[model samples]
Target: LRRKRSSVLRNPPPLTTATILSKTYYNVNSHQPESLDWFNVLVAQTIAQFRSDAQHDDAILRSLNNVLNGPQIPDFLDEIEITEISLGEDFPIFSNCRVIPVEEDGIGGGAGAAMGEGGRLQARMDVDLSDFITLAVETKLILNYPKPRVAILPVALSVSVVRFSGTLSISFIPSSPPTPSPTTLAFSFLDDYRLDLSIRSLVGSRSRLQDVPKIAQLVEQRLHSWFDERCVEPRFQQIVMPSLWPRKKNTRGGDDEDVGHDRR
Candidate 1:
């Protein structure tokens, strides 16, 4: 039995990066507009859903808060501090995007026992950005007109979760929302550009929480390919000029004047 199980586990089907990449590329390229639209819609929907859901259900809100503010979450939380973002010459976009904490005061108790002996779980989240822009671009020969560039000169997000104890049972009280911070980003021409990105204190829903790590890994891979297809490769081909550029040096000011003076 052990040998049979071991043999089955040993072979355990191959997971080739090429196959995964090909599939991901195909999926991303095939849908084109619909896929891009879905990204926008999904982001909006996620925020809305969390907001609405937390309004009525205290349990969900507490969970969200705990995940955001607690130390148990991912390490990327620290990297999300973005202070400024600039495309070319435009000012920064989006000051900040944040996840507000939910208060749990009078929820049920049977599940409280499972919450372990402690104070209520506390949680919260927030984000800040500097600037934004929109550009027309394409992927796999499919054009995506007016792609939005949401920049954060300095971006930050945070969450905290804590457990509280009552007389009979332990309740979870999510942390209060973190204070909002100011940030800035710049917008320029409707052309190609690279963004300085950051993230902090990201926590997912209960249903998706366990899969967060795996999902994050997959997301990073897909994001790289997606950006490359839509931005990097196109720029490399010189298909479009980036809005931002380095300033030229003023060599004619100091040394050139001295040369002219000496000659005179």
Candidate 2:
């Protein structure tokens, strides 16, 4: 049960990241009355949809199952039985998300925000919520006997991902020739996270051979490794600008192109 829980939480489906990326874009200068509010609303909407899916999405559950079955482990643990249910309560909730415009000296990544100083904007977002998860598991242990011993346990994991603070950089500059649009900003997550886990009493003699603290340590390591590899480890994500600017018309009677792209 512990191993199964680790598999699901430690290595979540790629779709989860994709979902977040798809929902973070907005145009601030649009004529709509709620243009400025659109970013926050969209972020909230993304969280809500993710929470719902974690609770009841069949496809997501199946994906988790596949991930579990795909891993190769020890012989002591033969068969694994995992529970099917929504991780409803474990979903993240946003407290506040705000975007502030500011001028920065440089923008990281190949993103040409630092080439010339036209304009730069800095944005920040934060999330606060109780991240709780529960799973039921059963495994068969082979003890050199005709009949294998079966062990059952319920696992409860509590991860407090409080205050997810991150910053984004955006830059815009005028161009003389047609170039690719610099209409996107890049951002990444930082290392502010906490997690906890509790395993219910074991039910078989084989349970005595299992070390609970060791399992917990493994979970902790997995969590930290994931953060180091994906979040806190200096990386940037590209976000497209919401508003579209007029493209520079072709002077030689060629196809019109975006002025921003010309500069790049």
Candidate 3:
């Protein structure tokens, strides 16, 4: 086994001091920072479309169920099931958009403010959503820390988004060569962003418990921890933006049932 492992463990190649590029962009037209007013109009239209779909289709709901029912349920928890989901009837209002230049290593995948040339442009906007988007779940809490199945407690929880107000920043990064990657879009929320949740919990069986304050507290904490770990300030997500190149999916009127719409 050691010999087999060693066979595949050859020495790694040495690193280059600096990456060499195959292409660089130089243009006569200056890269002007956008006001994002028109962009906001476009975004609002897109979100309206999404809400329309949610009202008629369960595709988004299914996706939520799949994501919430994570494969790695904790040992103390039996199964985490999403019993209900509400995408909400209201829309998010985006405003106060402006462009700023920052270094590439700052929060949201960029450095601090840039002085002159060595900086990237990013768009920051304020988003406010005061909708009742929610998810309700059912699960069993297993008391198996010191012993095996000493007792099984049922837990039903529902969390509602009372409000969310945030500063959202979006930045674009071009593909660099040597190993070419697609131009990517990245975005993240600032630390000052706020999220308000209303959580309700029911525990026990035969004689089921309802609205236990501690359970609600714990669930809210866990949800915040989960959100912070992945998307809050200093963290960001980069994804290849969908090709703006016109396609049948963008066709007016429907000959379409496109799972690719799920990409959003």
lDDT measured at residue 50 in model 1 versus the true structure, 0 to 100: 60
Give the lDDT of residue 14 in candidate 2.
35
lDDT by residue (tens digit), candidate 3, 114-137? 222455657788888898988899
lDDT of 2 by residue, 1-264 (tens): 657776677754433322433465544333132223455577667777786766665676676566655667565555555653434343343333444443343343344343344334444444443544555455554554455544433333333332233332233433323455535546555445443444342434544444456545665677667655754425444455443544443223447533344521
Determine which window of 10 residues in candidate 3 has minimal summed lDDT. Answer: 15-24
lDDT of 2: 0.46
lDDT of each: 0.31, 0.46, 0.71
Off by over 4 Å in 3: 1-45, 55-58, 107-116, 177-182, 206-210, 243-264
On lDDT, the candidate that comes out on top is 3
Checking candidate 2 for backbone clashes, the offending pairs are 55-86, 177-262, 178-262, 179-261, 179-262, 180-261
Superposed model 1: Cα runs more than 4 Å off: 2-4, 10-13, 23-34, 49-264
TM-score of each: 0.18, 0.48, 0.68
Residue-level lDDT of model 1, residues 1-264, one tens digit each, is 656776666653443434544654533233332223343456656665665665676575345445444676443333222222222222222211211111222222222233343222211111122333221111111123344232212222221111111111112322222422221121111123333322222343334322235434554455456555542421211122222322233225554544333321
Identify the candidate with maximal TM-score: 3
Question: Any idea how many clashes model 3 has?
Answer: 7
**Which 10 consecutive positions of candidate 1 have the poorest summed lDDT?**
160-169
